[model samples]
Target: MTLGFGEGRAFGYAGCNRYFSGYTLRGNRLDLGTPGSTKRYCEGEGGEVERAFLPLLAHPFILQREGEHMRLIASDGTRLEFEAAAMESRYP
Candidate 1:
């Protein structure tokens, strides 16, 4: 999975599909609006991950960052960790 933030929006490739949503961040609290994604069918692990991951966006999460590592902590204490990807010029 990959995530990027810019201009009040959060977008990423969510294992099986690309997703985007508006976001508001104040201090360590991050709130994501209803997300929108492409309708694509995927099987196996990607599909399973998508199912488990997307719903987490519905609730606010606490963001933690240390160097190149970042983590999103859900209200239920589920922690999603991510490492910074190399910046590419492909995205605008």
Candidate 2:
């Protein structure tokens, strides 16, 4: 799948949360700004956890790939891993 620039794009969830992040290859850092969370007040079991997690993404990240797994290692020793696979999308 084409991940595009992996930054400077608006990514959203169905719950209405949007994130704005940027990538800088020079310092090998992916930075996210003040990410605005969804305020529609749709509280679910995981709503509080999701809201808390989104704001914690303000730190920088370093992307590492191992096979199909893309790991976003943050500066604080936190790693967000995403598995890359062929999904049915417009590009496919």
Candidate 3:
């Protein structure tokens, strides 16, 4: 999955679908609005991952950054890890 955040908005590939939402960051706490996604249905694991990932955005998160790597930690402590995509392949 690839995510991009800028100007208080978030957009990313959620395994099967592309998702977009508004987000706010205040220190370590971050809040994301309900994500909107394309209506494509994916089968098997892709579908499962999309289902699971979208809801995680409903809760508050803690952002952890280390060099080019980042992790979004849910309130209950679930960690979603990501790395900066290469410049030539930034959008996915």
lDDT of 2 by residue, 1-92 (tens): 11323334423342334334443554556665545544556477456656656765677778787898777787778877667655323210
- For all candidates in order, the CA lDDT equals 0.85, 0.53, 0.84
Compose the digit string of candidate 3's lDDT tens values, residues 55-83: 99888899999999999999788999999
Best by TM-score: 1
Off by over 4 Å in 2: 1-7, 14-16, 22-27, 85-92
lDDT of 1 by residue, 1-92 (tens): 77788767888877898888889999999999878888799899999998888988889999999999999999999998989996322222
Candidate 3 Cα misplacement greater than 4 A, ranges: 86-92
Candidate 1, residue 67: Cα displacement in angstroms equals: 0.2
Per-candidate TM-scores read 0.90, 0.60, 0.88
Off by over 4 Å in 1: 87-92
Question: RMSD in angstroms, candidate 1?
Answer: 2.1
The candidate that wins on lDDT is 1
Candidate that beats the other on TM-score, 2 or 3, i.e. the better one: 3
